[model samples]
Target: MIIYLLLAIIIGYLVFVAIRIGLHQRLPLALGPISLELIPDRAAKKYRERPIFTIDIPCHWEIEALKTRYIDPLAWSAKRIQSTAGMLASLLQHQFNLQYGERVAIFKQNHFDIHLFTISIIRAGGIACPVNGKLSINDFDPYLANLSATILITDSAAILKFLQSGIDFGCCRKLIIAEKRALKSEIEVTALEEQMARSYPDIQIYWLEEALLSVQKESPAVPRGKDDPLYLVHSSGTTGFPKAVILKNGPQAHAVRGWLCYVHLSRTWDKGFGALPNNHQAVILSFNSLLLLGFPAHWSSSYDHLDFNAEEVMRALADGKFTGYFGFPVTYTQLKEVPAEKYDLSAMRIWGSTADASHEVIQRKFVSIGNAFKAFGIPLKGSIFLDAQGSSEVGTPSVIRYFTRYTNTFDRRIGRIGSTPFGPKIRIVKENGEKVKRGEVGKLEVKGKTVFAGYWNNPALTYQAIHGNWFFTGDVVRLNKDGHLIQLDRLVDVIHTSDGEVYSLPIEEKLHKHPAVFDVCVYAHQQPDGTYLPSVAAALKVKNSISNSLLLHEFNQMLEGKEKLCRCEIMEWSEFPIGVTGKTLKRVFRNRSEQMMK
Candidate 1:
């Protein structure tokens, strides 16, 4: 009887509340920031708009304004991206029997065609897996097993290498070759293709050119929802080859569209510039946003073009080539190394760099770099440099700090990365999963509209990565009282010595501030006692007459009396091996440590 009375009381309260809300004329339901009007639906259901499907999402924005060209080897606009995508989709479905949700690995470099080819995979409702273009046959073996991808699409050289190696990639059933450049000897290419077909008779091979030219559009798109997986990108393998992580359609598009809206990429923005490889997440974010928002893509470079010099970039811009620029630290730093008077950079706006933070010299050079931009106001600048902090998994940036080279009040400390970008709620948490107070050092966790779904086909790793809705970024950071973020080091990179935990970043940051130091890498060296000691490996701007011992002695003065564990050593740039992303790998230091002793 008491239970019935309580139930009746709750029901009456709900009914009263509902009646009052129903009678109100101006009451709008608010969920977060979006407001919804709770109006009664009419009896005619047929008059309502048709349900939207993920497949209905535009494969290509069909915006001719969005163009890409390559300057080094030279290519022009990618015409009819939509029709070409449809044709490629037809080929993938009919020729290779590509099913929706199946994986196709694209082993290619950064190119305009790669984007179109990837878009085709999307239209076919297949997961587009693009690995590092620099991966050799040996590297491909492990990735092949990891991806278990049914189809492998690559250039002529890669396929030939795999065939010549005589390694059976058991998982892949088909090979699709895209030989855009016809410079390779026709007979040699033909012989290799023939040999590949014979060696791997089980794996059927086809050409992307044939698909584009011959295939007629049949069935349109594979039915998929917005929540379905879109692109399978890699984590930034600053340490090693990163795992394949999945980015979904619904959340990705939602997040990307919002970011585009915030950036406001209009016609006035003009041609944007970026040299990020197609495999890099920044490339994905850039092209996808530009194309989707009807903004133009960057000019395409030829297939044979390996790299760009600072002079080439400056001359291009000086010739009224591009309006916007997005470059990595090394690219911008090259421009910085040369005198600013060497090039005319006045046409450029929205200049920025990501991937890695700038060194002290690079930052100073950036100040020198911004001096060329003549257009600006009190609050605005002729040109701004975005020294941003973000990774592959997170599509949108977490922190972005802009710099005007002309500012008088500017502090040139590169320690502070910046505040958060659009999308993603970031929290600094303790090991116990509790949020750390401001000015406290803790682990970084993120969750938002743009965060990746999880690592591809690795449930155990995925489980470890994501806790509930928040993804553990594995970076250890400190939030200062000013709301700026300072990256100490990666959680795994944090060395635990007798001093408890020693962050390499602070030491690196300090050493980098030294006049002679250009760049440095810090790693924990295992002593004979089995206790690890922090070791600093530095590359200097120039070789001085001072001996190595004196240099070490001078550098060690910075770490004096604080921690007995750290030892400073300066090495030539050639000796300190850098990875593809330009990070000094700890593994290389470890591998050569014994050699160094000898």
Candidate 2:
């Protein structure tokens, strides 16, 4: 009798899901004129009328801009974004001689221009490459050359960096400055332009304002087939130098369709905000998804992208009444300490995380603050925290987990692998490609429509990353007894102690529960005997009263055998090496520890 009841429940749930998905598919695509809002920007001015998404920065930055001049932020509305992008695309094609299929590299902080130029380049039948603006010139030089980019579009800060560093322009013949700025330290724009001319005489320099003057009528979008290359984005590069992943139209379109069916249509999200770095692939996905859904989406930033913090994000969410929020795990870490009473976040329905799985500790605070939806005219009190674990190569999330104020699941449980109909086909396989049994840890592999074509310009490395039809995700994971995916650690970061393999994530989770520990990264350190043991580097709270030794002792008491830390170092938050997409660079510390052992 119990078996029959269970079977009936499962079948009913499946039928309901099928009905929801089918209804979502029938919903019209690209419903017109989505509302877009912007938080106040200091360096922006209204260039056109009927601009719903005007730019404005924080008031503190406005005061600083008086001393040091800044560039004007880009502004446009949903109706105008495409038309303006069309004109820009026309300029690139006719004036700059940017041929179809050529690469146009963008080096700028997160703002309206990144999205504008991306769409413009796609419309022109060209591939858009957005480099991480936070990277130093030394780190940025290799990618510029590797891209063989025909055209380069950048902001004032990057222009200043290039002039100071004397970096080569590589294959790029034309450079377009996206904003007008009186160079910092009272330097004139013309003075910097003259310097650029002398330093890079072979490269033609064009100001964005001047380039837009020759604006042609909005040309019809250049037709593209499903497999045509759309963009080139990089992996997070936490382990090493980032790999350039090639994303095509077909895969991205498929992802959009899948999300629309299983995710967006099921939500009552009124306004949304994204705090993830604009260069990340997930940001582009969010931008596309919101635009198609006809939903209002807001992105907040100051003059300096890296300087934008948790406070600014909170301010935007409060002011915009954002119902849905998407960000990386690092962003959530920064927000964990921010008191709920300080910000009006009650309207938030969902706190969505991708790129990495967020800790339950972080989700618990947020989930307690808002209502997900109304039930029979009464609003529920708790929001949903949706965590999806995937990567750039996969193009879409493979595993998804959701936490509410009520969920009992905790610590490294990443939820189920794959979704209905359109999500990736996921597997846990040994190094030799054999499938792993339940509860056994193995490398995660995924096969799906949304996977990238390959790593750009590195076929040898790409070949190694794929086995038959499955793309190796470089993740060490296991299937739990409940059939959910449990994230152990990245394969490279797993500590191989003499006793056994110790996953860093679960150990870090235990440490994070302590009030004094602000942020923690647990990594493997090699001992004198060439064996590995877990070590910790942590940033503590400002008023933390606990001593390092006492904290370490407390942490160890929570752990059983092999996972206990060998050493604990209290470090400043800045001391942790972070990747472009804001993941901790564990390999750097691992390398340093190995050297110390040697």
Candidate 3:
């Protein structure tokens, strides 16, 4: 009997290996000409070797190239960035004295921040860096010196900030302030322009519109390649000083291609709606991937605006006929609050949730929408809701796990192997650097051409992050026996209690399930005696009428039998602060808790 069992086990292992190899061979053909190629001594490259067509949309101000085809040779040229690139090139050719390696800074004041300006600067062979317009004097001064920006292109607001901060314009040789429409009257406009001229006598201030009119529309082409520096994306300054993440063309192009394949954007029927802020990863995927793959995309001013009137979005779906949508868990929850039949969302083909993992409630809501579409006899295909596990450091696009059909079974093996049609290489490792057994939790690391090169500068930090060309995604995850990856929690968010116990995602997920809670953050509060207390801060929805005391009582009742949490560890409830990305700012909660203890 023992000999027969051993033979069966050996045969099972061989079958698994054969299946994995066969799937890898068949995937490219099944997914429409996508392949992963291993380059000899050049690192593994994953992309279509043949040139692929795409479309470029550079501005929100106009929709000119709505259905244009972007061929490879023309796309790499100066015109694809924006029409502004041609304008800047003309200015450089005529008015500005050309230097071999000069850097240019661009600032514009409009309700919507312009990404085209940064693209234009890169096309002009100039290093482009945009400063935060809202930063105080103390904050802005240090960053200015860090980049050593030589030219300034801004509006009155940025110029005024510079003046208020008493920053010497000696380093900045030229200052071109954009003409503002806010100065309504011609007389007022001229007077304001004259005043700016007088304020910076030595600095040259030229009207951008006037420059455009005088110069030719055609611009001299700037030579570029895969390794050219594209832009600097700054990290949020929540933890400490913000680091400038330097992104290059090679890695960025790889990311754009990977996104195109992952999202299946090459299909003519593909369309997406983006409501996340301009600076976040969702926008990056929507804009860059669309531009790179010729996919149609749309965006709202803000997610909050969309949440207020989700019917507007449904109306858009009916009018524009969108197929895909990307949003966070909070946005999904808001959609659940409204009745489904009020608007026609049957046009939606695929829906994605990012920034945070999808809660059970949100997943149920999505599954219901899918079921409703089918019930109405609309040809609405079953949807895909993915949990994207990656970081900004990993080129803003990385590993993805899709939940196509919602099930109560938490069998983590649903989508584990690269043998699947749409799966990437996944591995879970222990702290001492060994692959953990299946059904065990450990740090998750991913290796692919999709990963970012590294943080812009700060080599010391980058060295610590990327090991043997693999991006160490600071997330705790596990792979089940069925080969599916399950994310546990962020490494930093894990709370270590005084009793030497670790309580992580269970508390946060449980609190979020409460009817009174709209959102919640769980963290550790350290006492003067060095003992840490588990604290939970939450934001209750306006609709919930339960008092704080009742909410607390309900919470204690829920945790009575759970061995992971103690009764004494229950912290006070406070209003949760929100970030620009609409996530509950856990860092702010931790700070507030420390203040209360003091």
Candidate 4:
């Protein structure tokens, strides 16, 4: 009897050990050649189970709802997003034969369907590559070739552009036409699937709308480990062809964390509005950050981005319903032109800018607009502006600093964009890897959770950008006495003259302070003598006139000794042409100035 009892005790002990081992054991999940570890939710777990996208999921505006003048009538609830994404994953994997690490290039703007498509691609273990719809067919050709995409999903506008150009979809095996439901009537909608099937007999074409509703298969998200590549985002090819950057899952998650930390989002504030393009990483990462945050923010409607409607956005802000607002500096430049007292913009508590720094004049104007409704005697409250200096590789802003009406101080300095984001450490380093002293200029480098993995298929460029774990941001910055980082210019933007190196941004930012100057870009022009002259082209405020001679004279007086320049041109703000992304084409202006001056 004693022997039997001892044997039973030993068996029970062995069973306990087996159960413990099983709990800790990790399995590697493989989709084709890519292998990922599905770790138990402990750290860096993004959007596992929470409300992500907000609204009715099967989001078609009812015939009655569509009659309303709401710019973007579609909203998607979280469960609807999941089920639609799951169905999409199944269809993409089974029908299109998409595998791990394969590129699926999508040409689209900001819309709920595009967001759903992106989630589906990642859930199906494929890289979602969103092409900038603003790029011309000639500019877009290399990206398609470089991607070697197995699938191409595009909108009607892109298709129309392709038809107008010599570029062909020879590289893509399958095509998806995602017609914008809201803008279908604006363009001449066609039955292109049938026409394309007839012309390209070898390739398959499918309509995105039909598939979303018809595909019944379910494939839930496979937990890809945090470090795996999730997206392939292209760089703005101002200097040359765009480099496709590999966005890793870990950094993608970090973007959500960084934004949450930077802007203290309130659970009560349910709606946030941003008019970013579909390709922007901030918009892409927001779809996943739903793990911690309660509700998803809404994107602006699928209207022509180049022709931005100020009223469409201002009306939304003035309605006093939204909790947050995000836009580019250029957008704010246009917004400040509208009278602040005309609208009730006080409801927007959290406001931020992503691309370029808001001109100090516009910065002060936004704070004033936020505080306009406060009683004349009472102090202002609940308005924050973020000068988020960011890029495609940094996941979110590498530098994030805020200015409130109560906290802001006037300091005449160049590149006062912001400071470090939540998880990254920003350092000003010299070429030799030494940290720069305060008040000295150096290259900006970032080390953190959100730095990108590398440039897609371009290891040489990747190596040049990242040293060890630190990614070298090509931006030039200096540390102020208060330890705040000031953006000077892009390394490429600085030009060397016979006198010395001249940073154009400082010259331009200083000039912008002049009452008559509304907007300006500074570039270097080379003369027949081979000496580079720092030059300025400025846009004058409406009804304010300044002559080119007087402008040059005033500009030269602002500079001392070696910093003085020989040329300046003053024109109306509308005269300065912008790129499709709405950035001033400084290189183009420099070339034109070179021709004119020479």
Which numbered prediction scores highest in lDDT against the true structure?
Answer: 2
State the local distance difference test value for candidate 1.
0.60
Query: What are the Cα lDDT values of the candidates?
Result: 0.60, 0.73, 0.53, 0.65
Q: What is the C-alpha lDDT profile of model 3 across 203-271, one tens digit per residue?
A: 777655555556646454465556665555555453445555565666555655555445643234446
Candidate closest to the true structure, highest TM-score: 2
- Sorted by lDDT (best first), the order is 2, 4, 1, 3
Across 1-598, the per-residue lDDT of candidate 4 in tens digits comes to 9999999988876665433222112111101122211211221243343444433223332222122422333544444455556777887888788898788998754455666677778888888888767776886877788888889887766766765574667578787776435546533444554455556667776666555554556676766877878789887665556789888876666566555555545444335776656576765665454323444575664323255566767776777366567776667766666776677777666677776656667666676555321322246654666677777888778766666676565342333334443456777888898999988888888877778888987889999889878887778887777777777777777766887778777777678778777788887777667767788888877554767898888888888775677778777666776654456667777778678765
Per-residue error for 342 in candidate 2, Å, reads: 2.8
Candidate achieving higher lDDT, 2 or 4: 2
| Full-model lDDT, candidate 4 | 0.65
Better of 1 and 4 by lDDT: 4
State residue 176's C-alpha deviation in candidate 4, in Å. 0.3
Candidate 4: where are CA atoms >4 Å away?
1-73, 180-201, 290-292, 302-305, 371-378, 407-422, 557-565, 570-577, 594-598
Tens digits of per-residue lDDT, candidate 2, 1-598, equal 9999999988887666544333433244422221111201100122223334444441111112111222333334455555556677787888887778999999876665687788778877789998878876886788788888989998777888999998887898888888644333445777877898899889888777666667656555677777888889988887677788999887877766655554543323366676667777877876666555544566654322146477877877888787877778878888877777788887777888888657878988888977664421345688888887889898888877778888887768886766523668999998787898888889989988889889888899899998787998989988787888888899999998999899998888888888787888999999988999999998988735666787789889988888888988888887898766778889988999999976
Report how far off residue 387 is in candidate 3 (Å).
3.2
Q: Itemize residue pairs with steric clashes in candidate 4.
A: 400-419
